[model samples]
Target: MTIPPCTESGSSVLDELKAALGSRVSTDGELLQNRAHDRSHHDWAPPLAVVEAASTADVSAALRICHEHHTPVVPRGSGTGLEGGANTTADSICLDVSAMNRVLTVAADDLYATVEAGVMKSALNAALPEHHLQFAAGPGVDATVGGMAATSASGTTAVHYGTMKENVLALTVVLADGSVITTGSTTKKTSAGYDLTHLFVGSEGTLGVITEATLTLHPIPASTKMGVWSCPSLQHAVELVVKALRSSLRLTRVELLDRVTVDALARYTGYTAPVTETLMVEFVGDRTEVESQYARFAGLAAQFEAAEHASTSDPAESSRLWQARHDALPAALALVPGSAPLPTDVCVPISRLPACILATQKDIAASGLVAPIVGHVGDGNFHVAILLPPGDERAREQAEELNARLVERALAAGGTCTGEHGVGLGKVSAMAMEHATALQTMRTIKASLDPRGILNPGKVLAAS
Candidate 1:
């Protein structure tokens, strides 16, 4: 659908929106330019205006105005998405909810918390420490709650605590028509009419704008231990991790970093470790149980000829190690200064992970791209940050082609095109191949809920 260029009628609609929203509406050129793109490699024309919604009522009003004016609306949070999910078009209104950052209620007794859409994951975790609880599922970065919910995000802790789809109990959403509705309840289990809460969890704001969320929290683990193992090769590292998963030991976090990624982390974060294929493992539980699990894992690693590179029980040291792992992308970018990162992720069955990653490594080597591999291999997911020179269209095409091949390999291996990152604008093409006939059902649902296609146009589904 071609979004019409803003005309005099659009100006009048903007004036009406300003009248209704007052100082909340902004036409600042600098801000508009900054909001035109996200952390992704994709860039678009600047949005016509930005509406910073501070409350559910503000979201309702903004959506109501945009719906009536036939204007496109792109819902956004912290703009930390790596898939261009929050990027806006030239004729659209960017509905930013970052200012709606507030924790409304914390039910420590019930192990749940109700927070506004814009609450940052780090901030929420910080607030939960006093209650001996935490919001377990996070996407590594300090992403907004609403954004995480919108993308069904999961990170290091997902292996144990589950993803957003499992943790979110309810959502307060504003529909495209400006109607407000609450889905699900705080109850643990309910034979409700429909699971609308999950339907919108990974909808990418194509159906409605998430305003608030009721999330389940977990008690902070009493004992946490982090360790890194260095393997002779990537194959050995992946094989050992798979073996550990099948064993009796329970691990909270299992991350794999290729040699290139390890080198990047060493230079960028000043972390000292053996420069080889590495597996970062963590165990959390009762002190005795944690230590038992660690010892069992050590034995398993030894069988694969892996050496213990580092181990720490101190909270500060463990945090530093994990932070370096999370900084893999930036570290990769630092390796090749003045280059853009085209990061992509894919997931396969645990048994096929070694083969998939090994083949991908070969492809990367042949393509001569500075793409480093890092992943939450415990769940069969990994990411490749393909770095390219700025404005190098030829190199970008080569990288995209390589990405397509990678997705094809995963799909053939009974895996998904994306593991954590939602299909914003980057992975839309893979939807049909990944979902097959189910793509039509998705389109039907999108049409039913957002008939006008005003919410986050050109995202997730094509021709939305």
Candidate 2:
């Protein structure tokens, strides 16, 4: 999808966009400033204009204008993505679909739900109970479905249900050329010619703009169980959680929080941190089965000489207990005022989690930086929320030391630098190291899809 070359008339291009989108388009300072960057907290960059798209047609129409103008477009959702995936380049435009929030369709029988790109996770979860169906997993799904699919995000539940790449059934995309394409179906399974469904899953809007999505959903768990396991150290907790995941119990989610992170959550959310480094485990099944699983799981944690085992079957109690797990990101971020959370993720084989986590802690100590570690430990993935002093160059410099070590340690432990977060701007350099020859293949794909390089200029692959 070659956008119109910049060599052409720029005024005509802006007019075309205005004619197509009318009131949906705006050059408002506030909206442009807001859309200029994502949750990345990078220096704000106001785009030339902002297009608050309302429908697929609106997106298509706006893209056509951007194409004609050869203007770069930053695809934005809730602006909740930590990475700078949605930062518009100077002179570019921001395509915000926040108004596209809608639950398009729900196939309860087939266990599927279709939603627009701008629908919030809480909104979808709210509507799921009517049919006893909900989206199973996404990248910490507090953001819109489109953003999650764009990044191919995964969270704790991804250990069991998989990530957006695994669950995204189909997408309605507006390409760089202003063409609309549907790549996959919402069916349970398919063996089609080209699996474009997976292609755009994590393209981060460089390849195309995702306007809508059809997603696979799962049944609401009949019964839910929660438990907190406290261990002497991070290594002990990781060891036991790894073992618990490998065992017979079907754990829906297992999140680990080191002592510092636990304390941060305690201070922010008013939830008491378990006395020791802890792993929060959740299981879902039939009422009786859930009880049996909880009992057996608690026994396993106890075997590790876990300092304590707190289990709850009550829904309200379970929500409160697990809120810390689900809300760890926002809650922990709140602990450090004015400073944005600089989170680095590393994913290694399950067996290496303890060593990787311990090494990370050591690196943090060496750097003399305080980092709160938390993440879905079920898949050997963990996040160290490095709270840097706002606008303090010295703190950021030190944080980079720990960040680089975090990557090195994960690679040394046979894990990836990132489990769910896409390599927007922050991880591109690391990705070059991780993918090696494979990185070239990704670049080729990007070039083939976006030869003119107008979609997103500096993301994933820099312009050649």
lDDT against the true structure, per candidate, is 0.91, 0.80
Cα lDDT tens digits for candidate 1, 1-464: 23345688679778978999999998888888877778998867778888999999999999998888889999999988889999998889999999999999999999999999999998898899999998989788889999999999998888878889999999999999999999999999999699999999999999999999999999999999999899998889888988888896688999999999989988988878888989999999989999999999999998999999889999999997788787888899998889989989998998899899999999999988889999888889999999998888888998999999999999999999998998999999998789877988999999888888899989999883
lDDT of 2 by residue, 1-464 (tens): 11223333555666777888888878766666667787665544677678889999998888877776778888889887776888776568788988999998988898778889999878888999989888878765478988899988888788879988888888899888788999888787888778998899989999999988888888888999888878877767777877777786788888887877778777877766574688888889899998898788778877777855567889999877877777776766676677777877879998888888777888888777668888688888888888886788888988877888788778777778688887788877787778777877888888777766778778877544
Q: Can you tell me which runs of candidate 2 are displaced by over 4 Å?
A: 1-11, 326-337
Candidate 1 segments whose C-alpha is farther than 4 A from its true place: 1-6
TM-score of 1: 0.97
Give candidates' CA RMSD values in order: 2.1, 3.3
lDDT of 1 at 411: 99
Q: State the number of backbone clashes in model 2.
A: 3
- The TM-scores, one per candidate, come to 0.97, 0.94
Model 1 clashes, total count: 0
